[model samples]
Target: MSLHESVLCSTLPSQGTGTLTLHDLQTGTPLALFKHTSSSSRCVAVIPTRAGLGGVAIAAQVDKAVLNVYSFQKDQVLLKCVLPERLACTAVDKRGLLCAGGTAQGRIYLWEKLASGALCNVWDAHYRQVTTLAFSHDGDALVSGSDDAGISVWSVSRLLDGDAQNTPVPLLNFSDHTLPITDVVVGIGRFPSCRLVSASVDCSVKLWDFSTNTLLTTFLLPRPISHVVFDATERLIFAVANGPEGDIYQVNLLRRRDDHVEAVGGAGVNDIIRLGMENKNEQDPASGKISVGEEVTVLSLSLTSSLLLAGTVAGFVHVYDVHSHQRLRSISVGAKITNVYAMLRPPDLFGHTSLVAREGSIPVRPIAPLQRTRATEWEGKEVGVLLAPFGKETAESLINYPSDELQRDFALLLHTSPSNVREEPATATNARVAELEAEISHLRGQLGRAKGVNDAMWEAMVRKVVAQEKEKNNADEGRIKKKGKKDH
Candidate 1:
């Protein structure tokens, strides 16, 4: 009962059918397609069970309020558990002993796996609809994100250790986002200091130091980010923007510009490096140009960190080579791809392969353990920098100063008039005037070029309007002729 490497795609069927298809990653062939009686079942997470026997727990939303857990083994559902809540998001622990889900009413339910494939000890958590969830690699903490733009870190041990009747408080809480959180991933190995990354419809991704409840950095994107995943090394973040023309972008976490403010509160702004654009000329003519703005609904990263999978609302799954930024293949599942999971074959232990895992095999870089006192000291400095004024100089002096001498002299001696100053050498003054005149001429040339572009754009718009009017008139004339023929 060894689990093989595969990809699971949950689809929204066009004709009142919902399906969960398992495809072999090597051959891109469907191994099995599990069709549901309900038309809108969206399979969310495929997690390995902890029962010593190789099995998978498939969580799917059968409807708005009912989540169906199908225990799958050898391409068949052996057991089923129905959770009575409208679940919006779910996550399973690494050991598969516990499962967490967020509901529409902003409650979180933690279901511990029992001996006979039953889920029990449901714990209520959160005050808003949970939108995303992730389990820390060590399986000690569970992180949940909700529509309230809040993230809560729950202790796994406390939830399972204490009485089921008591509601556990979050270990840490974060509320930096102003919109619904779209995805969350906990850092592992090198990032063992409890680092969490979250993406949101606010068009920003934030890196949080969960140990101290402080935001380390924020990455802003052009459009709302719907999904985010860490690369194999955890040094880069791959995110999918939400829109018809939404693109996949790779953000380098370690790279920061020198001009970037290193303060905690002020985030460093960097451009998203676009990746994996399929060549339009090489694609199928029938498919056209991928529709102008098809939204990317889901994203998954391969275990090797070399490949990326993006599922679109247009019913196409695009595979990309991460390093080359090229689309390797475009799989059309004939339905909207709601979710995609990359199931990596587990590493051989004592010559026996265990269950599958989602993360890659790349070794994590060793990062020094974060010091709490150092972090606190830096936070104070950041606040000081944010609150500090620009300078003591007047606004006019600050605005007019162009050189070091002017900044120092004019700014300090604001009461002194410029006309009373000593004159410069005649040649130097002439040279300065000439330089200023040359700059003005160059600016005028740029303005002329800009005006030309604006005029061209205006003319194009006018022509388009005229063409639309002509088409409407032709349609009206055709209707009038048809009416005359009928009257006759």
Candidate 2:
């Protein structure tokens, strides 16, 4: 089946029967839909599994104490497990190794090696009800926010160290905001380079570098920020303010005061961009922004398509172009959307959780159900869970490998026929194969420009490396000549 480059998922919270829907990132086409009773704000996280199908989403159901693991490809709930506490927000690492949830009582619960619930830890990570939670880029740290206006970064490695007598304290804590925090976004950088952006009811967004344990910059806005989101590149940030006539604010991380600042309309800060304000950009209708009303509940961004999704309480999701400030598509979901998650979905993954092999496709492995690690008296306190690998693993699906076989395969496929070179007798299989071949042909037609850019970048990097090596050789030769003259 042909799938879009990314998937946009949202859940209805206030309806009599909660609904979960996944749509194409750009066209807003429904990919999958199902009825799910559990819902909450910031409740769903769709992650990419090793298997190509829709990776499992860790969804926190508000009406009940259990969380539902939904498989996007299968369009069904994989598992529903009871939680130790009532969770308000939940997050999973990119590797799907850990599942973190924030409880209404202001505690953070982490299940490490999710398949083996054995590595469970709970800590009082906040003062009031926890509002949001996010895993750091490397998944080595977890960032949690609470209604008490506190943001804490917890070290995952240290927590699992298990040598300490008591629970470990957070790696760092920022108590700058005075009101409840609505959302937090962690960049894909480690150590001193890592940045954490947060929005709160205090009408301000603060950027912090956890490594130095200090605030980097604060962007004060006109109204309270209801949601904050970072694109895949993290170059731009989208922060939505609450209330009627609320406009979406765009903040550029790479920009400085030196920039011309022509794109934004009367921005309060050089780095913070004010988008789509009708009063200021009246002459340029395209410059004007969409006035997302107070009822807007969920906001998700697709960097691939440069589209911003705004889900409102009135059961409508409006897609707006971030660059042109034009509304692209509006989807009427017919219910209040409380939880929404947008992610890049990989192609041709497994059809189900069973890891059944399909023709001309590879199965992306899914994480197994949560289990406990039992400690025996003989082993004392050090208990470890061992994962015995059992699943379909394709040689090409492996991201990290020492062999250049993938490069060779790419080159070989260039001359290969567009259709599956293998002849098949079945009509349904042939039709599916033909459809895939046409999709491949269409993609290759568009890949020329992108492929050129990609090759240019690679060649440029290779040339730089070659030049550095040449310089090093020249320096060594000059040193040898000087040494020989000294010896003579």
Candidate 3:
């Protein structure tokens, strides 16, 4: 697939009734669009691995009480883990370990893929439903946020060392939420310097400097934060919340302007208190400028924080350019997109949650456009949406056709073969391939004249590839004809 096509979303059709569809952010095309076969999926996580750079998303089924894992590489379920009951939530570490929190019960189970290609690690922790889980950058700690409004940080190595019958003590239990804690994260950096951030239903995001075992900052949001993430630079804390109007906020933690330190610890000035700094409207001591409207509900932050992505029940994923504070783009997932997740790969990754994949390009041919209904007349009932991945052009076209229309389109696509080599004289095919390769070589030279990957470069690359493939086909046909003559 061309870089453009690779970014487009492609749907995988399934006969199941309980399907969950994911549209690719690049092409706005359906990527592995499917529903749960047995029941509604309770939780899903994307995992990226070397097996393929793409992600493998795991879905927990409430009715089946089993976890289904799939990679974009294949349609079949890669693995399944039977659970004691329905899982409320799940998280995948960078290394591909899968963990789930029980729904009705308050236990957390750790799962690992065994050498035999089966899932292992069946156990539980916590006294209640675990709503959120995050693995530290080092893979040493696993933190979970729960309905209890308490955040617990656990030692992954220690958990693995425990016997099947032994219970473990939590490294730290930061229980201070008046309401439920919705999300938790361990800051990135060297060991012994890790920090933790927690979002609460109480409308605040708390930063805990774990080294000091104290709360670093108490950030009150414009609305109750549904999610929180560190920006690409890790200096800015991003958050998402619910309000009458949809908005996202960024919190700058490095500014010493909020430097009023009141000790909250016992017996001495042991703990630092940076109060009155909660609201950004306060005057900054450094620049002496009063800031306003700095708080935002963070929906999702890119892995590196180069971009801040947020979504609200209002059905839009707002992409902020970060440093510029400029609105880069807004992606409309259409149906009230309840959750907006950032996978290393495109949102349509079917297999693992991560985005790294090596081989195989799932070609998705566009379907015919459907008519707009009265309700969708606002957007012209167009089957396609423009994606703002970087440079602004209608780079991708999403085909959200009706089921009947999709069937017809799928059949039509099957007839269009990828242009490569052609069926003709071997010498002629070889010459065509050489010419196309030479053209691609020349295009590489022209790249030095441009500043970025512009449309011209993309067009040239696509044309070159198509030509090469056609030439390859022709050479294969020539070889077959030669064999036929020998038989004669």
lDDT of 3 by residue, 1-488 (tens): 12122121111123333333454443344465544433321266655433313345566664567766655555666556665567776666666543434464667766543222212233455566777777777677778777777787877777766655567667888876778877776777644478787888888878787666767667666567676777544576666555544445566665543657333222212333233335455333332121223322235665445555554334455665566555666655433333445543342344633222232232221112111111212233233222244653222222122554444433333333333223356899899999999999889888856736576789999999999999999999999999999999
By descending lDDT, how would the candidates be arranged? 2, 1, 3
RMSD of each: 32.1, 16.8, 23.2
On residues 59-113, what C-alpha lDDT tens digit does candidate 1 reach at each position? Answer: 5454655454443433444344555655677777776666676667877666654
**TM-score (C-alpha, index-matched) for candidate 1:** 0.60
Which has the greatest TM-score? 2
lDDT of 2 by residue, 46-119 (tens): 67645333356667777777777766555667777776667899888877778888888997777753445544
Indicate whether candidate 2 or candidate 3 has the larger TM-score.
2
Highest lDDT against the true fold, candidate? 2
Measured on C-alpha atoms, candidate 3 has an lDDT of 0.54
The number of clashing residue pairs in model 2 is: 10
**Stretches of model 3 off by over 4 angstroms after superposition:** 1-32, 37-42, 51-54, 62-64, 75-80, 98-102, 114-124, 256-298, 344-488
lDDT of 3 at 31: 60
Better of 2 and 3 by lDDT: 2
State each candidate's clash count.
8, 10, 58
